[model samples]
Target: MNAVPFRRIGFDIARDVLGKPDILLLDVRDPASFERGHIARAENASPINLGRFLTETPKEKPVLIYCYHGNSSQAYAKAFSESGFGEVYSLDGGYEGWATANARAAAAAPRLSETLKAFLIAQGFPPDDVNAVGKNQMTPLMQAAHLGPAALVAELLAAGARVDAMNSDGSQPLWLACVGDDPEIVALVIKAGADLEHKNVNGSTALMYAASASKAKALMALLEAGADLTYENDGFSALDMAGSRECLDLLRAAQRRLKAAS
Candidate 1:
């Protein structure tokens, strides 16, 4: 049998803790220690319950593990690697090192308001921080889609905002763009990799929104982007939601095309 390989990352290099969407932060410390303070969004899964934790976490996602001083974390990291995790890392100095360096920065990094967001973006703020959620769990990109200047939406997308990020209502930025009836914004989001088939809490998709709102250009863009025509929400498909004759015609044509291809 061979030992699994994993990386050991120092506090300095691990500064972008929450930036990666697929990175899972695991704090394998005592419950009391975790309760006192652990990294933001880090899950506490003590060694005693390691098996259960591993079962719940996705093996494909990168896992960063930390313990009291770092020794215990190495064992956990190795365990994750051996269990088929693609990327595993042990924090070099563990929680003590991170807290000493990042506590203040993390605490001070407030969610930006739309006005402040615009100001900072104008001043060249990093786009990766666009994931920062504000009121109603709306990411900066979602806010931009809602408030637009379509250019701002494009800027955020260029900065690597996750196009599929859902708001409190499970509405993604693409859905909001459709709701706003901004064809340009809808196109920008689709170009930036928005999920055309993403459904909200009510199971209504962006295509449905575009059709219902009579957004001809947006509906056309979605169809071109391969939005699923057969997707039904609460028994209503995009074709059923088409409010205008033009929208209905487009959806029907698309449905026929898809049916023929299948």
Candidate 2:
């Protein structure tokens, strides 16, 4: 018998699949079990009718299959894979496992909300002392920059967080944003007046970070923002750190343009 490729689904995976618009959840259990309690939007297609159901259902969408204790689902998942379904999953512990995990998450819901609220408040408020550091010696602005959430970065900046504040390792917010490779977040910090030329402990700048991370869009954004290409750290310029061929070509062309202009 040929092996069929199928993923083993856990509660986390099932929950993620539920949110996708193009997902098909299959409950292979008997009618009574499905009617008692099944995942929202799941379809009941018992083993006997599975062939007919497969003929009607779209194969391109992800299919998540589950039975009483997951054993039956594995057989169904293999069948679907053999029939050329691109994405097939067998729920590891079946519907029973999903129900138990959901209950646990529900019980912790209030604590999760409070923790989220505290995080939001910390980003929105100004630091009591501008130089104050957290556990890792990272100020609020530095931490926000590393996360690459444009809204949080904006909130921190608006709260009077210093754009040039350095972490313990001497990395600035712009450098951290470049490391995250998010052009929008990088642009946000730039618009908020972050220093494009500021160097970290190793003397590397934000442009170097973008190049090293192979972030072509971010590298382009840095170039358009007028980052100095000639600047070098330990004798290695942004051109040297350009990890992708596309970024290397862009850096070389930009360097030529800068030289010509000078």
Candidate 3:
């Protein structure tokens, strides 16, 4: 059976649909509010991001949308539906409504596991430091950047995980993104205000990591973002770390341009 489009679902239904892997949850709210908080794994809808979502998201994936008071979601739902999406839903009361409903449910909800709390303590985090990280201080955002569907990275960034939080060894999330080799995630971090030239303990910049990992797209994104090719990590410039011929060519070409412009 074909699923209905622009269906407004209450909290109960919304909750169930959220667990589905194929569902695309979108929060159609402003960036600041999204940074404050929103549904887990939910992508924030901004003008530019919405265009990308509409372009890239598969039409078959069911779309679940919510907004501040729920009214705006219906309009967004209509747009998604008209754009040929198969299943699109709007939260009945929007985020505010969902919050109210969720609060009511949590009142009787089972207590959260102390196992996680214990694990956090063992990992060297202070008892109240609820930020997900181990003794190494690699936040969830860092892990997701290094390995992701790219959506999780976006969700974490929207939910205000510090984009530039470095690990014990001083590896930034942007560096991990280069290891992951996803240009899209690199761009996402860049948009989230990652310092392109911020170096680690060894002074390796994101560009250096990208070159070492060997992918034209990731390296290209950093180069296009104006990453400093001159900055050497432990005296190893990105040119020295170039793993792909394409990246090498890009570095050389970008270098010549820099010289000409200077």
How displaced is residue 177 in candidate 2, in Å? 0.7
Candidate-wise lDDT, in order: 0.77, 0.75, 0.77
In Å, residue 12's CA in model 1 sits off its true spot by 17
Candidate 2 deviant stretches above 4 angstroms: 1-117, 120-132
Q: What's each prediction's TM-score? A: 0.56, 0.50, 0.50
Give the lDDT of residue 196 in candidate 1. Answer: 83
Candidate 2: residue pairs that collide: none
Lowest-sum lDDT 10-residue window in model 1: 119-128
Q: Sort by lDDT, best first.
A: 1, 3, 2
Clashes of 2: 0
lDDT of 2: 0.75
What TM-score would candidate 1 get against the native? 0.56
Residue-level lDDT for 178 in candidate 2: 78
lDDT per residue for candidate 3 within 41-66, as digits (tens), equals 68889666788888899988889999
Across 8-42, the per-residue lDDT of candidate 1 in tens digits comes to 98875564444344568889889999999887568
Identify the superior model by lDDT, candidate 1 or candidate 3.
Answer: 1
